[model samples]
Target: MQNMWKCMEDLDQYLTYVGGPAGALALTGVAAASAFYLASRPSPEAPLVPLDGQSILQNKDTPSGPEMIRVSKFYKEAKNGKFLSYFHEDTKTLYEGFRRGAKESNNGPCIGWREGPGKPYIWANYNETLLRAKNFGSGLVAHGLSPGTQTFVGIYAQNCPEWVITEQAVYCHSMVLVPLYDTLGPDSCSFIINQADISIVVCEDDKKANLLLDKSPKSLRKLVVVKEVRPATYQRAKNRGVDIVKFTDVELLGAQKDYPQTPPKAQDLCTVCYTSGTTGNPKGVMLTHENVMAALCSVMAQLGPHKPNKTDVLLSFLPLAHMLERCCENAVYMVGGAVGFFGGDIKNLADDMRALRPTVFPAVPRLLNRLFDRAQQEISGSCLKRTLFNMAMSAKESELKRGIVRKNSLWDKLVFRKIQEGMGGRLRLMVVGSAPLAGNVLTFARCALGCLIVEGYGQTECTAPVTLTVQGDHVPEHVGPPVPCNHIKLVDVPEMEYYATQGQGEICVKGSNVFKGYYKDPEKTRETIDSEGWHHTGDVGQWLPNGTLKIIDRRKHIFKLSQGEYIVPEKIENIYIRSQYVEQVFVYGESLKSCIVAIVVPDVDVVKCWALENKIPGTLSVLCNNPEVKQLILQDMVAWGKEAGLSSFEQIKDIYLHPDPFSVQNGLLTPTFKSKRPQIKSYFKPQLEDMYKILM
Candidate 1:
């Protein structure tokens, strides 16, 4: 143990001086050194399962639930479940699944992207896509990889067709894939590589490669540059015994080599997806071929209209590293649909959306909220427009609740048609996931957009889906019933006062969709998946009246105040955000504080409007610090809290309104657009402390 610690220290120090592939090799040497030391020692008793870290204990009995939901149930119960017949499910492995889908629609255009707005789209048909995947797989073999070798491949890129090809190649060759999000920090990139023991990495560009170089894991042996590599990078990698190759070269080499005939097995390890860790180090969720298959099958069984068709086109902008986007890509491929990649820039997503005119769009809440906010801005531009928009929105909401729509609806045609047309007129469905969608966005989209909005709840551990809202059953608050693949039940969370018997408790899921375990972490695996094969999700949920699940709060995020009063910060924050005066908020309370203090970022547009309404003159910066403005916002927040039924102790006592909003660029928001509370608290610790003192 002491030797191991010394070696790690040496490795860390050594890595600071090295750069590029050499740095990665130097880091990998530490693992080699540890292996050498272990080899020299006297042999210890080997575990029964050959000690690959998984527990050797026999499987236990399954837990009791309200009968596990099955595909047949989905077919019988879902609103448009008959569409399940179109799903290609005879194949067990993802590679085979892709093959069957591609074969069924060989010459159809599949993936597309453009250089910029008005640029002609570059496309690849299904036949071309499959050929490229095979060539990429052959390239892996040419690079001395073999099927069933437990090789780990890392894809460190943003959303691109190459990302999809590389992913499919890795799976086709039966290698485990570790996806590193483009937004991840250098340290996180290294941590994932080390945790997954990835030997080869395909980076998006030279800058991303350099980021990996700063903290390159010792396990990394090769760097595959997708765009281009600098000469210095090549030299650095060469010096460190790392093989650096261009993606095109790999494909060319693979085209000359024989492709592997053996495909991935159903239970084969598919991916090691590391969670976007908020509080601590991210854990790698080990998903299998079976797990992904189950998730895909379940989605098809539930979201009937979502099954893509020949004419269906999708806009892909979200980070492909996210499971939701990845699963959507797979589903699109299965149905022989087209996916139009964004123009490699988020600032241009709107232009891309308008140009592509996608029929299917999968979005996170942040994007939807932005659209809603934009509509509000336009509507509020003129009093007449505001009144008309409100009338249209209200009428549509009524129509939605009544479960009916009129052909060539007058309100929709006059007031909301422009909004739909602006978003490329042909949108049929928008699937929202990754985080809870705001209620206001749901209400507005349902009435104004005239497109189906499906909001669902899921985590990475369950292959990105466990429950989802189905077509024709748009209960925005409830994340539809558990999908066909899993059985879900509630378990008591005593400390948080969540009770299973009362239909409110921590959600526990069990089925093929549940992950095999966390990669290389048996203790964490045991903690997550119990003896009864249930994955104990830390989220709290209650059964909705319609037999669906309503996620309330996180069991792990509830913190007790100084007075021993428990506070669910998310609930309070959500309530406070309902006020148009706020943009973003972080609720913080230490153990010594009797009341919570908030860090708020006011909505500049709304606040400016308020200043105008009250005949106060100032810029946003001035208004943010104005005592009168602060008091006005505080009153609204308090009112919102009271309306939410929060206890007095739970109400935010004082606030430090921040001028800047919480964003991914500032390390305050995750890639999914969820607030990173720990980072935010740390960033504003001094301000929060002063505010708490004032409250005291």
Candidate 2:
């Protein structure tokens, strides 16, 4: 604390020396204002209390341990009208599931999208989706698409009715669906198209179609334009032996022909989902119809008897290329629920939620964090509001401590009720996955949203979720017990010295949910999925006292310094991010370095407020590069590291403050929001070299 005061005094002296009394006065005023604002706002309630080595599951009489203990009974158990065995194993393919679902509720609303925020809505019933899917399949056949060949068909589009139709058509025609995220750049787009050997690509717009055509991979022999195609662009494609077809033209041709009678078998190829490639080139994850079915069905079994049905509505805004949203889409359809699309603009997502009035919401942690941040920001805007909000939060925290948070309380009516209405008052459950959520954020959301918020854990290889919090479970630290139909175990990671006996090691999974293998990479496949059929997830986890799994870090991401100090950058990064000053951060260390270096993206609002208080001269971007500002942030990080109880070597020895946050568009973040460490390191190589040289 003395050191911080000394630094501030030195900064003030330096500013006065540089620009006279005016500069010093500005710094003093800004600092005072920042201090006042921070002091006025109430601190957020702390993260949920830990289990204190007691097993919550055992205490509650829930089935305990690694969860595989009950796998056999759950797999074969026939309770109520549910199937006795694996029902998904009986379904030949996803197309069959869709066909059956469509048949059972032909008049039910299926797919829907809105033109814009508060704009007109569009929808298609189950019968219409089935009819269009049939037409789409026949249209593909008319274009010489051979069934049973497992040809690759790429869908480079967002979540829309057309994307759904294309997916169904791929399944109906016995072709493999390869999804391309809408945000993918040309290089990644080319790499995936060529890697997957995709012959036909369906794009959402002319811009995306043209971009793909520009890459013009040799395997891409046809292009289907879903929205609009100009004559000149069509002629250009035709000249290159690339058949250009309109989405409507394909449907018309399909209407003229009969839909194929034979659907792919259960074990046949379904989709080749490519990883977001945070490390290097993305690998194509080959999933069979059975694999997808198992994953979706496992989720259903985990949900118990109350599965989503026709009365439920879900808002789909996440990229379809990602496994979670894709699975959510299929699962909603499987349960015969209506799916609504976002209004395209992210800024209006809250409005979309209210407009759709969705009953179920499946989301990622980043989205959930944003929602929490927005709520807090609004509350902090006024003194009276902040006081009321703090009281409500305190009441909620008291309820959490007493294990009565799930019940209606006075705070709910006084505060949380309006918050819930903002998120479409009908929402019963919200599933969060794709990334670990901050426990405090999770706790606040459950209290604020007035709905059950379940955290799920899994990767694309397992289709979606491997472990999910049960409907009644509210523990925030653990992700929850492993879902039925899947078994998980921990194996010792010798290099990191993590052992299963100590309740920490690399997570390994085996079940119907695991993917077949990486497409065209038998060596990698063998490496990941052992002879025993257990897929080594490369994720580090520990068993909580409750027998639920808690992810600690990524095994592959751990690095050792020259002094043999093992460090998990992600773990450290998470700690640093807890500070309000940090927006995003990347920790870098190499074998030759005895200490770590960091690249940080400051929370602009926090930094700007601090800059004003310190009388720092410049805009937020300029302040990022100012030596004093940089040093101040470094000091803040050092203080945070101490607060987190990090080891000496784990502390950042030096840092480079980046003005811009890592993002997908800049290739420093994956579509899923995980940092692309290699890319980030490469992008800041010069800055890193400079820091190392200064230390030398």
Candidate 3:
């Protein structure tokens, strides 16, 4: 044991030395030897059978209906008349859950935030956070805000200590938390404020306060700013008959008086999360305490031995307004784990990661794709480095195929240590959700990071996760079986020629984790959740031979071309985006047109590299309009489509290269980074027409 430790220490020192000038040559020899040693190791132990799940038939009359799938444990529990519901029986509400976490953690670090760019994170212990939540809840009551499940409290902010504190405070008073973000737009905010009857809103700063004041909703009577409120903003609020106060002042007001806690019941509404609709006004998804608790239970079950504990630290950077991030933070808190907020700016995410060294990371495909691109770029810089990287990745991938995961292998030390260090050097598990991650990217991440990367699939309606890939599951294309909290089945989609009997159709979920309904729209609620209680997800899925689920297409994004063929734009976009030259893509087809067109946002770095190689000189915007550049990208995309087995009509007939990427700031993407297809089409209407005209 002592010799092993000494060897690891020596390897670390050698890796550090190799980064300097003199040791470069020596490092190449070391890397080659390490790769050879790794490849020569004896065959690993037999791979563990994936504990994905079993499928059971639910209907006898419907012979063609697909059987419902459930994890083995959940299936057994259901047969025994017992279901896993909450994290803890005693912790029925969010307030009680936090109190239990505080007790179990023994006043350990609960929430933390950085003071500034170069400063260390400041932590608030569990006891301190709980007390502050209590005080804040009391303050809300003192400010004439009702304290009950009927009262909705709005929180408009980025991920910060104040945001979690405000959420806990709302739970303490049994009130519903309605989170708002800038990407939802001003009209959506106004509609939500009026629909939910939110009387008080907690703003991150004076700017957010002014945004709410400008809306001037009838239900909004007061604003609580986390930061200092400018005099002008206060006067503006006053002119609108809305009272404005600092967040700290409210806490101080509650500190002088004691208020009894009003904890919510199991079925009480915990939050009203609004969805960023593609075409209509956002719908408020009402998730109950039981719903969220069930989701936590499901997450824990999915993690198994890898579930987070008090020692784990999560870096909270994804938008808290989204259910995925919110559920991730809540899961961390439930286990008494510490959560550190990222600096408001995303560019400083690396700095934050280095400072926090988070043990667990919850991410989205957009961010992971960027990391994958960066790693590829770094590896392709030199011949020797690229050779070593490929050798290391091959060795690690071999081990992964054998159900073995190791972060301290010889290859890890000789070749991939720098990649691990770039991500804080302590990431044990990474959960990817909110969008489908390409299989190649997932495989590369697992090999490079030397950690378990689990991909989950779900939406806000299901409290973030319907199914999560389990540990030791090496297959990257499928997102494992249904989670313990929910059972899933596929229903037929005749228009798309997808059928449950054929193991391909729309995904439907049913369980405690499902949201109650759309806040006040019974019609929409009925349209989503059928009478049988299964939430019909518009995403088309296929059941793989291994019993795992794979998302194949989207029903809502399908459009019929004039030739009487249906085109799934999102499906085509996913294929085209695999091209190195394409960063973002929007595929558009009109009912009156026989062919489809695409607007592509080329990856500037890769395109510029290509331009340099071809001796073509132009800026990104100029290159976007260059016919040769457009043809190069179109050819690459066509190749990708062909490789993916896309039909001829599904391939792009004409292409337009756009200089700018789709982004939330441009109202072309949701906060979760999903492209808003309708808005993207509208934004590029002229370009689409020009492409069609040229093609004609």
Candidate 4:
């Protein structure tokens, strides 16, 4: 242990030196961390499977309500003696039963929608979709394929039924589905499929098909096309004379159906949504059948979980390639709820939401933040609504502080009622996850919509949900206690630490719901999981006095100051980004020195606000490059960064504000919102030189 400690200390220093020229600045962060680690207490073992963290927590304090919140019951319709689970009467289990019902109801008064262009969700669960997936599942399975049969089945398509159906079909048949984001270019997409040993290809368009054939391995046994913009791409794929065809052709060959064949048992592999890391190749996260199902259980364990019913409808607009949306798809299917698909484009999302009038929604922080900004803009535009909304929001915040959701008032009708209508009159809840949402966004949502807006946190590695705050139990400071059936532990690392534990070190988990392991990488699996089976999530977290977990930041990302105060850059950045003008921020200053610095990107719409105010705008895109706008943002960042993050290390030493937003097309941000740290740093290396020169 002593030698091990020495080795870790040496490596830690070396990392500080090697992280980049900025790494030397992290020396203060390291010394502070070392002292803090010495002062913190030893970590306790994470509770075992039989034990419930929530139960232990509540018992220690004043017990909360029911031990579990079951969305399973919501999935079924009430009947004579026994209720039918979310699907048709003939259905057996929650897994296939809902799908079966959906298939039967297809083209039977089922509807599809997206009212206009720039509308996000157009067709979520149209009749043709369910029917196609049922056939699609059986078709692929007939080829002697199942989940985990090959490493992956690439679902590369635009936002359409083909994407959803192919994903479900892959899930039903038990093949590890890797849904590739369309925005991810040919290089990243091809690399992921190859890394996962994708056996079956469900390419959406001809462009993707051509790209696949060009770079794909000879071992790729089957290729099927779905929706495509250019027909020539298909001919290109066919001319390869290797092995590939359109999806329709695959369907023709797979005519028979042993439908719902052995619904994937809990232990089976589900999907592997690869995520960006401090990179070598992107890691294929192994999520199990039960891992997904456990997400429902954990959600139910929270307050006011999803309520699935025939009348309930969900807006499927967020990228289905994402886990939160994917899991919502499953939960909605189980409930026999209608899914309204938003158009592929984000610009179209708002109109789509209004037309769908969806009863439920699962959204990312980015979406929620946009909504918040829009509502604020809407209010600013109308004085009558603005005054009422401000007063209502103030009252709502007070009630929420006490965990009491106040009854609706006349103010809602007079002011924000249309806001709710735009989201669909049926919206009972809008789950916000994927990243930390601004507190103001949360406040505005609860006040404006009067619908439940809960937050959750997870990664592609955990199959998308680990902790969530239920509707009634919404705690603002912490994310939430661990969901039921999840064993969340803070492992104490005496050497490399960030979360004080107030004493614990690394956050760890041991659960059947944990992924089987990274696909085809035994060494990586061993490194992630220890001898006792705990998966070491590189995140740093500490237990609050109330027993809830507060995540500090990625352990590797946290740094310190001369006072031994470890500064969590992401946390500080999350606060800085709360500014309405700031779209995104990347904090820099690892070991080198005293203060933090940031690279800032202004929100397009927010910048338009400035143009409108000055009466000097062309369009949102045009106004982004306005020199005056750039100068305004730089001044704002200096004040906003320091104020939000506190002083000392949190203060911005200098900033490099850019008119352009980071995007995959531009090679700035990953598909996931994580900034490509090295890529961004390199692209702006010269800018950093200017920043440091000025700061010094």
lDDT of each: 0.71, 0.71, 0.78, 0.58
**What TM-score does candidate 1 get on C-alpha atoms?**
0.71
Across 495-582, the per-residue lDDT of candidate 2 in tens digits comes to 6678886878889887777898998889889999999888988888888766678887567886644332347788889888887788
lDDT of 3 by residue, 354-387 (tens): 8898989987665555556565666565766677
Which stretches of candidate 4 lie above 4 Å from their native place?
1-131, 141-148, 211-214, 228-231, 242-244, 256-263, 304-306, 377-386, 402-408, 495-504, 558-696
Off by over 4 Å in 2: 1-85, 88-92, 381-383, 394-410, 558-654, 657-696
- As for model 4, its CA RMSD to the true structure in angstroms is 17.7
Q: Could you give candidate 4's per-residue lDDT for residues 1-696 as a string of tens digits?
A: 011111221222222211111101223443453344335423322222221233233232432342211111111211111211112234333345445546644533233555456444334454466566667777787765764435467776655666666766665666667877543445566778667766677766666676667775554656777654356654555565545566775555554654564455556676776654433455677776667766654464354334555566777765676677777766666555667666554444555666677777886554444456555655565555555556557655655654454324444444456666666656777776665655666777776676777777666666676666654544564566565545566665654434333434577765534677887778998998889777788777666554556666565665533221246667667777877788888887632233567788778777777778899857655665576776677667667666653544456766666767889988987889677776787888888777767764
Q: In angstroms, give how far residue 431 of model 3 lies from its true place.
A: 0.7
TM value for model 2: 0.71
Best by TM-score: 3
Candidate 3 global CA lDDT score: 0.78
- Order the candidates by lDDT, highest first: 3, 2, 1, 4
lDDT of 1 by residue, 1-696 (tens): 011111221232222221111101233444453454334432222211111111111112432353322222364333222212224447766777776667656668888989776786789998888788788888987887767637888888777888889988887788888888643556777988987777789888888777777775788888888888889988877776677898988899999986765678888898888874333467889888888877877776665545666678888766677678778777777666788887765545556767888888887664555456567766564665666666557656665654543213555555666667656778877777766665777877776667777777777898888787755553466677677667677888876677876778888887777898887789989988999798988888887655677888676766544322346688788899998899998988763345688999999999999899999999888888899899999999999988866657678888888889999999999999998876897899999989967864
Clashing pairs in 1: 22-240, 27-218, 28-218
